[model samples]
Target: MEMPKEFESFAEARKNNFLNVKAAKDAGKKVVGTYCTYTPWEIIDAAGAMPISVCSVSDETVEDAEKHLPKNLCPLIKASYGFAITDKCPFIYFADMIVGETTCDGKKKMYELLGEIKNVHVMQLPHRQNDPVALSLWKGEMIKLKEKLEKDFGVVITEEAIKKSIKVKNEQRNLLKEIYSLSKLDPPPISGYEMHKIFDATNFVVDVEAKNNELREMISGLQEVAATGNSPVSKDSKRILITGCPSGGVAEKVVKTVEEVGGVVVCFENCSGIKEKCVNVDETKDVYDALAEKYLSIPCSVMSPNTGRMELLDELIEEYKVDGVIDITLQACHTYAVESFSVKKVCNENKVGFMNLETNYSSSDVGQVRTRLEAFIEML
Candidate 1:
């Protein structure tokens, strides 16, 4: 049950991460607040600014957010906007610039409102991934973003810097992928809870080298333990695959319910999981084309006819030997909410149990969710 000592630091890093961002800001470092994974971190890094996800995963500020946003909006959007309006999140508060993408109608509109208060720039994200026009538009947006960062930070984002950043970010992705792949083993070496903590804290741990090193060490330790048949998880536990909206706000409710009821989540098909980290940018290609190709390829439900998600789900389900697929859709996230049907179809085709739960960042439905998850896993 023992893990690498670095596991403990991830928790500590999450707690004091804001201070790190504050310190960076105080030291005259430019901080860019990113909402979606589609934002190119390499470009921001190349521009001499630190890119941090400002996505709020709590309902503490949802009420404040609802004051301006509709009461029925997605909690992720509400909480994010709430943090911005209330200046509750240090990442958003210290952000020199907030980079948003038109990933969804809610977020796109939210960015418009957010711009009224903060320095916000919205990228016109193309939803059609395979369309040539979409890639061109995305590439153009990447250049615009690069230009915006340069203009704001007074630094040129040279091609050389971007290439270097692409390598660095790719390295981080590969490390994370290796860590997550550890779950592919029977009786995964790490618990789903522990794995979630490591994955969630990735953005908070800004020191890429330290983060990568910690992951490498964790991987080594985990492989050793797994090889010795000393896994923290039970071999007979139901292997679950979570696919849906970002799970950060709802992980405590969902992941806990699964593990507490004799299930182990081996794959996360959502952004909080492997959705963004699974693919690496092609270093040989032009920086803009590579960024466009890699990001646009992400299988978020925002894309029209998101067949990629189904393919990814199929792959992960087979790879992890999933017993059930839990599609967690946030309230009013119409894209994922509606896309759940297709996800269920995919699960059925793969002969896996499928359960779609539409909820929000509120604990009010925790009991109900747990009851349903218990029934679902029991059925599985």
Candidate 2:
């Protein structure tokens, strides 16, 4: 398939992400590696440090990680550990410090092992997001993170810096939301895989200004395509909404299989998808408190009461006019695996087609996944 002209720049940016990080490091800038969206990029930017997400989805590294990690753990954790220990990922190697969050037990335990290899600061994320004490504790954790960054980097993170960073990040979020809105159209200008790639590429780009400009250009290009009624997917294609655990490299396989079987993924409510871009930090309030509230607002499975995620999913299903919903959970990701029941229940109540797909990083299950996806598409 030919690449879209507007997305070309972003594709180039993704291709050179490692080089960009290396250049920034060589120029005397501190780079912080993170795994989850809950890690506030605004805070890292304010501290004069470049924050890059370090999640890996390649099956190639799983064997190396399996030597230490359990065989049945989440592939994401294993791949991440594999990349770190094998020195295969440049971003992980370039990071001056890693910010770990207690988003899941697998990650929390994996960090203990990771810390022995690299300098890691773990953030104690609260499970009860609705309680006042939980919010206060999270706020304190953000403050503690800020202090640690300042002490380690020898840079003062001023209020002005934080506000500026929030403004830039908010702009990015707005642009992403606009891009997601296009999926609601009768025939989206871009494919789901294309949209996922655009969002995924942003993880490595440290230059927010440049990324924002690229986003604006891509939006303009999409607008032109929409005006011409030119779409990458057929109008009769069955629209799908994928929700569950984050699928990094496997995202391409899942999306490709759906498309190949005559279904189009109109939206995603996963970690690396639209959910992360839906909320923005309020610059009007105290930046610290605002950051805490914004990050904590993310409906991660770790939260005790995660009904917010279901609410958000329902909204997207209606907004996108989805015909079916696919919940993709990496094998042994217990939290999301258990949460799949709630997603299925909600889908059944709404009379929307639902499929719970459980798989791992290896390509050995590609045929099985494809067959199941093909059957699901036929039902829709």
Cα RMSD, model 1: 4.8
Q: Provide the lDDT at 145 for model 1.
A: 94
Off by over 4 Å in 1: 1-13
All models: lDDT? Answer: 0.89, 0.88
lDDT of each residue in 1-380, candidate 2, tens digit only = 22233323334555477667878888889999999999999989999999998857777689999999999889999999998988777778878999999998999999999999998999999998788898899999999999999999999999999999999999999999998899899888988888888888888887999999999999999999999998878998999999998867688679878988898888989987988788899889999899999999999888878998999988888999999999998998888988999999889888899999998888889999999999999998
Error of 2 at 191 (Å): 0.4
User: Model 1 lDDT vs. the true structure?
Assistant: 0.89
| Tens-digit lDDT string for candidate 1 (1-380) | 12223324334555488767767777788999988889999999998888898858999889999899999999999999998887667778778899999988998899999999999999999999999999999999999999999888899889999999999889989988998999999989988888888888887656776788888898899999999999989998999999899899988999977999989999888998899998899999999999999999999999998999999998899999999999999999999989998998999999999999999999999999999999998998
Report the number of backbone clashes for model 1.
Answer: 0
Q: List the residue pairs that clash in candidate 1.
A: none
Please give the range of 10 consecutive residues that has the lowest summed lDDT in model 2: 1-10
